[model samples]
Target: MKVLSGIHEPTKGTITINNINYNKLDHKLAAQLGIGIIYQELSVIDELTVLENLYIGRHLTKKICGVNIIDWREMRVRAAMMLLRVGLKVDLDEKVANLSISHKQMLEIAKTLMLDAKVIIMDEPTSSLTNKEVDYLLSSISDHESVA
Candidate 1:
C-alpha cells in the first residue's frame, strides 16, 4: 500500500484533513489535525512509563494553570481508559521495556488513542504479534476509521 501526505508544493496533489489543505496549514496546525502513526517496530522510549510514553511528544503539564499541576490524575485516568478500550490490562506506570511484544503494541495503540488522533497510519501492525494478539489489534482498529 502507498500513502501520500504532508505538503506537496510545486506538485499537483493536495492533502487535507477536516477540510483544511495541507499546503495551507502550518506544522503546528497540521499536528493538531490529528495524524497518528505506529510502526511495525515500536519506537517508544524503553525507560518511560506507559503514561509517559503516551504523553511523550505532548506534555499535559503545559495545560496546567498556576495552581494546577500536570493533572497527572487526569492523564492516568485517560491512559487507563485507553488501555481498556484497546483490550489491555497494563499498569499505566509500568516501564515500556518491561512489557511483552503484545503489551507493547497495545500500549502504542493506547498512546495513539490518547492523542485523539483522527487519522492513524500503521505499518505492519501485525508483523510481530501472535494470532490472538493480532485478533485483538484488528478488533480494536475496526472500532475506528483510520487512514492506515
Candidate 2:
C-alpha cells in the first residue's frame, strides 16, 4: 500500500494502472492517476478548521508577483460541495477539534473524494470507531460506490 501511495518503492516490480506503466510512481504521478490512501489513524489537524484542513497540503494557491496567494473564496465553495457529497454538514470554519470522531473520519473521506480518487486504499478504516460510527462509515462507502 505504501508503494501505491508513493511512500515506498518496490524493490523489483512494475505497477500498471489501466495498463499504463508507472515505472516508479511518485506522489505527483499517483495523484494524477487518481490513487489515494487513507490510514486508520485520524489525519485531520485539530488546530485547523474543516475548510483549512481540506486545503492543508495542496492549497488552492496561485502565484502572484512571486507570492503564493491562497484562493479562499474558491476553496470555501469547493469545500462546501465536498461536504455535501460526503453527507456531512459541518461549518467550514469550525475547528476540527470540536467535531466528533465520526465527523472527523467523515472529513478525511471528504478529502479523499475531493481528490477525485478513483482508487482508494483505506487501512483499518474502523479501528477506533463505535459500532454506530462503523455503520455510518460503511453505509457512506456503499453510497459512494453506488454513485461512482
Candidate 3:
C-alpha cells in the first residue's frame, strides 16, 4: 500500500494509472492523481477543528489585498458536503479530540472524499469500528463506488 500510494518506490515494476506509467512518484503527486490511503492508524489532528482537519494541507484560499488567505466559508461548505457523504454529522468548528473513534474513522473517509480521490486504499479501516459502524462504513463505501 505504501508503494502504491507513492510513500515508497517500487524496486522493479512500474505503476500505471489512467494509462500513465509512473516510474517515480511522491505523496503529493499520488494525491493529485486521485490516489488516497487511510492507514490503520488514525491521521486526523485531534487539536484541529473538523473543518481545519479537512483542509489542513489543501485549504481553499482567496487573494485579498495582494495576499492569500484561507477561504473559510468555502472550506466549511465543502467540508460539510464531504462529511455528509460519509454519514458524519458534526459541527465544523468542533475539535476532533471530542469525537468518538467511529466518528474519527468516518472523518478520515470524509477527508479522502474531499480530495476527490477516485481510488481509496483503507488499511484495516474496520479494526476499531463497532459492528454497526462497520456496516455503516461498508454501506458508505458501496454508495461511493456506485456514484464514482
Candidate 4:
C-alpha cells in the first residue's frame, strides 16, 4: 500500500500499473494515477476549518494573469457534497479542533473521497473510534464503493 501510494520508491524493483513502469514515485503521482492511502494516523489539521481541511494539499485553483487563484466556490460545493456522501454533516466553516473525533474521521474520509482516487488504503481507521462511529465509517466506505 505504501509503495503504491508513492510514500517510497522501490530501490531494486519496478512497479507497473496498466503496463506503465515506475521505479520511483511520489504522492502527487499516486493521486494522478488514482491511488491514495488513509493512514491509521489521520492527518486532520485542527486549526483549519472543515472546509479548509477538506481541501488541504488538493486545493482547486485557476491561473489568471500568471497568478494562481483558488476557486473557493467550487471547492466549497464539492466539500459539502463529499461530506454528505459520507453521511457526515458539518459546519463547513467550523474549526476541525472543535469537532468530535468521529467527525474528524468522517472529514478525513470525505477528503479522500473528494480526491477521485480509484483505490484507497485504510490503515486501522477504526482503532480510535467508538462502535457507532465504526459502524458509520464502514457504512460510509461501503457507500463509497457503490458510487465508485
Candidate 5:
C-alpha cells in the first residue's frame, strides 16, 4: 500500500495524484495531497465544543499575529457550515462528551469536511449506529458520490 510503502518497488507501480506519484513524494507532502482518514475509534477532545474540536487552534489564523490565538467566531461559522454540509444539526458550542454516539460520528465527519480534503477514508463509521442512522449515512455518501 502506498500509505505504508509496503509495495517495495515504487517504480513498478505508481500511486498518482494530480499527475504526481505518491511514492516519490515525502511523507508530509503525501499527507497534504488531499487524503484524509477517520479511524473507527475517535480521539475527540471531550472538553472542547463541536466547533473547537473541528478547528482546534487553526481558527485563530485570521486575527492572531501568530498561532497563539484563536478566532472563535470564524471557527464557529466554519464549523457550523461543515456540520450543515454533513447533514448534522447540533449546537456547535456543545461539548463533545455530551453528544450522542451518532452525533459524535457526524461531528467527526464534519471535522473532516472542514479540512477541505479531496479524499476521505472512513473506517467502520456506522458499525454501531441504528438501522435508520446507517441508512441515512449511506444515503448521504451515495448522494455525494452521485453528484461528484
Candidate 6:
C-alpha cells in the first residue's frame, strides 16, 4: 500500500493506473492520480476543528482586494456533505480531541473522500470500530461502490 500510494518506491515492478505506467511516482502525483490511503493510525489533529481538519492543506479561497481569504462557508458545506456520505454527523466546530475513536475513524474516511480519490486503500479500518460501527462502515462503503 505504501508503494502504491507513492510513499515508498517499488524496487521490483512498475505501477500502472489508467493505462499509464509509472517507474517513479511521488505523493503529489499519486494524489493527482486519484489514489488515497487511510493508515491504521488515526491522522486527525486533536487541536483542529472538524471543518478545519477536512480542509487543512487545501482550503477553498477567494480573492478580496487582492488578498486570498479562506472561504469558511464553502468549506463547511463541502465538509458537511463528505461527512454525511461517511455517516458521520458532528458539529463542524467540534474539536477532534472530544470525538470517540469510531467518530475519529469516520472523520479520517471523510477526509479521504474530500480528496476525490477514485481508489481508497484503508488499512485495518475496522480495527477500532465496534460491531455496529463495522456494519455501518461496510454498508457505507458498499453504497459508495454502487454509486461509483
Query: What overall lDDT, based on C-alpha atoms, would model 3 receive against the true structure?
Result: 0.83
Question: Model 1, poorest ten-residue lDDT window?
Answer: 1-10
- Model 5's alpha-carbon lDDT is 0.68
lDDT of each: 0.71, 0.82, 0.83, 0.80, 0.68, 0.85
Candidate 3 worst ten-residue window by lDDT: 139-148
Better of 1 and 6 by lDDT: 6
Model 4 misses residue 2 by how many Å?
A: 2.3
How much is 83 displaced in model 4, in angstroms? 1.0
Q: What residue pairs clash in candidate 6, if any at all?
A: none
Q: Which residue runs does candidate 3 get wrong by more than 4 Å? A: 63-68, 145-148
Error of 2 at 22 (Å): 3.0
lDDT of 5 by residue, 21-137 (tens): 654545455447766556677767889988779976456555355546556777777777777766777898889999888888877766766666667667777775777777776
Writing each residue's lDDT as its tens digit, candidate 6 over 87-138 gives: 7879999999999999999899888878878788888887888888778767
Error of 6 at 60 (Å): 0.8
Q: Which pairs clash (backbone N, Cα, C closer than 3 Å) in model 2?
A: none
Q: Once superposed on the true structure, which residue ranges of model 6 sit more than 4 Å away at CA?
A: 65-67, 145-148
Best by lDDT: 6
Candidates in order, TM-scores: namely 0.76, 0.77, 0.86, 0.81, 0.71, 0.89
Question: Of the pair 2 and 5, which is ahead by TM-score?
Answer: 2
- Can you list the residue pairs that collide in candidate 5? 60-71
lDDT of each residue in 1-148, candidate 2, tens digit only = 8798888998887998988877688888888888888877788999999998998778897788999999888899999988876667799999999999878988887888778677888887667567876676677666554222
Cα lDDT tens digits, model 1, 80-127, are 878877778878889889998878877877776677778888777777
Q: Candidate 1 lDDT (Cα, whole model)? A: 0.71
